[model samples]
Target: MNAERVERIRAALEDAFAPCAVQVADESHRHVGHAGARDGRGHFAVEIVSAAFAGMAPLARHRAVYAALGTLMQTDIHALAIRALTPEEAHAAASRG
Candidate 1:
């Protein structure tokens, strides 16, 4: 299940952003008794840093990633947490902390 989600996310971003860093974490265990996980679907947190997002707004970048995932949202995925950013933004975030 986690493997499938990882593959789907990887394929989506690889095809769309050609990301420099892509990390997909299955956080289903965190919501063991949560509403969405009752049916056994996967809840994921994705952290992606890519050059493709350089000029895009945050909403646009999120939409682009969601679009890339396609039917997986309706079928295999229940919730997705995304931290999508360009390399520069990622660097800024890192420096901030």
Candidate 2:
């Protein structure tokens, strides 16, 4: 997985969502030898907390993330796993932890 590409994803998300917290993980190592990995695109997981996600449904949240990613989805990224949440949800999760 390319560190530069991962950083690009994080940057894009931050610009789009103004997230309070964001994490981007490259999971391509786990998919080594898979057909998608062979093509050079990467698998990534993203977790973001932002006020922008407030009141959005789960699917809508995911779509918003995908939109934020824009053309990266067609080029650098082969697959994505997203965990999007509002600030309040993030706070609650932290409290639970």
Candidate 3:
């Protein structure tokens, strides 16, 4: 179930943003027995780099991600941690690391 949710998330983001890179990680195990995880929905983290985010503010980028996820926000995902970045920003961060 968790793996399926991660794939759904990745596919949705890819369709919406045409991302240069995208990773969706299921982090539910770390939160086992937590309140949100009780309902069977999973927690996830996404790191995405896309030109679609180039001129967008952080809030806008988050909103766009939420929008792309649509009903999965209510059904499959209990929480989402997002790192939305443009390709240029991704490269800069990677270079520094």
lDDT per residue (tens digit) for residues 1-97 in model 1 = 6897778878887888899999988888898999889887889899999998888888998899889888887887889999998899889999999
Query: Candidate 2 residues 9-89, lDDT tens each?
Result: 999999999999999999999999998888889999999999999889999999999999999999899999999999999
Off by over 4 Å in 3: none
TM-score for candidate 3: 0.98
For model 3, which pairs clash? none
Model 3's lDDT to the true fold?
0.97
Q: What is the lDDT of residue 37 in candidate 3?
A: 94
lDDT of 1 at 73: 79
Candidates in descending lDDT order: 3, 2, 1
lDDT of 2: 0.94
Q: What TM-score would candidate 1 get against the native? A: 0.90
CA lDDT, every model vs. true structure: 0.87, 0.94, 0.97
Number of the top TM-score candidate? 3
Global lDDT of model 1:
0.87
Which residue pairs does candidate 1 place in steric collision?
none
Worst 10 residues of 2 by lDDT: 1-10
Using lDDT as the yardstick, the better of models 1 and 2 is 2
For every candidate in turn, the CA RMSD to the true structure comes to 1.3, 1.0, 0.5
